[model samples]
Target: MSDELDLLRAADPAPAGEGPWRDRPLDARAERGLNRLLHSRRTRRAGRRLMLRAEAAVLALFAVLAFTFSDAGSSPAVAAPVALVVHDAAPPLSLDALARSAEARARTAGAADGPHRGSHLQSWYMSMESGPDAAPPVTVPEERITRWNADGSGSELVVATDPRHPGRPVIHDDHGRWRTVSDGKVLHRKSYPAGSAAQHGGLTARTKPPTDPEALRAHLAQLYGGADGTSTTPQLLLALSSFRQEWTPGPRETAAIVRMLADADGLRPAGTVIDRLGRRGQAYVYDDPDGPDGASDATRQMVILDPRSGQLLGLEITFTKDQPDFKITAGEVMSYEAWLP
Candidate 1:
């Protein structure tokens, strides 16, 4: 009994550092932990014994049970983790249907170009709320107008603005479109580009895109991937995205691309969302190769679709996990773009 009492005394943990709880008796849970500690210590001090091993097992089991049956009021009630359920009511895959509808529109649609103008205007809206800089991110709600037309010929415009305000944001007015980079103490400016989602594919009066889905898919696969086709989800997504960046698919081509996308792995419907152009569109997410359940550090690519006209409206890239490097929070918009004709 004396030896046991001495062991208990040594295992006492009421006070971690000779404080108020130091001399006090341990709680039920604490007692169990301390008892295990005491036995563990005894095993170390004296050579391992079968009797001691059995006793240690029995004590460990009791400790676990004590934790299991701990009084609800005595300890904080633990909430059962809720598993997030997404896509429960989502529609079945409809890439084929969407493509067919797009092709129908193409049949009745105007020529790829309204009229070959001397110069075509390229207006791109960008939402780059976060970037890879160390400073607090600035929102760039601005449009970039390049002299280059849809046919892709033009000189680069270089405008000089105040370059001193790296930490401050530059905003462009919708009415004026003029931005002030810096004015000594007063400083702000406009924004720049996020990659456009649905581009005219840089197809001009001369370029021809494949109308067959299989051919289109292979063409795009070769364009984005090389001789060895990319079967991975992220690669296919980026490849399709690359096609949209330079070319706005004609109706038939758009339909074929949509059909091919149906079988492409890693793409899943994320439901409807409004594009930057304020158009209602269906949103699809390309989840990371990692498990879908991991919210943190998971990354996704977004493609917005116009179901009625089978047009690809926008594209977005966001993170499910917080990105400290970019000073972005989880679910924060990384970059979004809506294309315009």
Candidate 2:
């Protein structure tokens, strides 16, 4: 991408050359001058004379323009930057105000409110290996629903299925980190290794929801490729891992996304229809941007739109990078979805 931009910048046309004689064509004069200079070996003086004439013509033009546009005898000067006294009256945003603003922006941008309405069934799969030889992969599946109460606070009920214990749902928090309540007793408790609790706590304290989908997409794209530059499941797992971060929606950013979607006339219709998946979300795939080698990666972006009001649901990024030899590794899908309270 950077290379392509550099190439475009380099292709700009150069300025036209100036030569002797303000009104006369320079082709005949240059041809005669070149032949004389080459044969007589007097190119330096001849070149200087030609340049002096061109400079004089430029000076004459500048003088004419200056006189014609003069307001007085003084020359025009650039104005200095003026510092204005801005009042410190701007108020800090309250949590309610932020939420309302985000909601309004989402509405204006045509974000549907469906995902927050009905029950949602979400399924996630992840696999990671520490070395070339490691234990078998781990898989997790979940089903959930988004329910809002009269007080505006909401809770999600998640029932996870473990392959080893089929049919028995392992109820857990929306985060999939804690076991859910059953019969008022803590039926399951997740044990963290020493120092893991501090790390998890730190993550919670520092995490803030992203309002910018573009930034989120860029982040997912980077993670999907992995830290060690390996491809495949690592990228996919990284994409899913983003959900752990809280999604704080920003009004202005959401509105901008909506306007782009509403005005997408030149864009080709996605090969796949934008349909609802996992109960109350709509999905659509689009082409990926060209990569470093001026070639488009086998990457496709999936954006989930809110099924209720058609607002942005979430974003999924998938792309493949070339591996050694002629083998091409499969890309992973990473995504972030909005969390409702």
**Quick one: best lDDT, which candidate?**
1
* TM-score of candidate 2 on Cα atoms, chains taken together: 0.31
For 251-325, candidate 2 gives per-residue lDDT tens digits of 544443343333322222232222223234434444545421123445444544453333454444444554222
Model 2 collision count: 8
Cα lDDT, all candidates: 0.44, 0.32
lDDT of 2 at 258: 40
Candidate 1 Cα lDDT to native: 0.44
After best superposition, candidate 2 residue 189: deviation in angstroms? 9.4
Q: What TM-score would each prediction reach against the true structure?
A: 0.49, 0.31
Model 1 lDDT per residue over 158-251, tens place: 2222222334434432221223342222222222233321121222212345777677666654333311243455545545544454455556
Model 2: C-alpha RMSD to truth?
Answer: 29.0
Q: Which stretches of candidate 1 lie over 4 Å from their true place?
A: 1-93, 107-133, 144-207, 226-228, 289-297
Cα lDDT for residue 53, candidate 2: 58
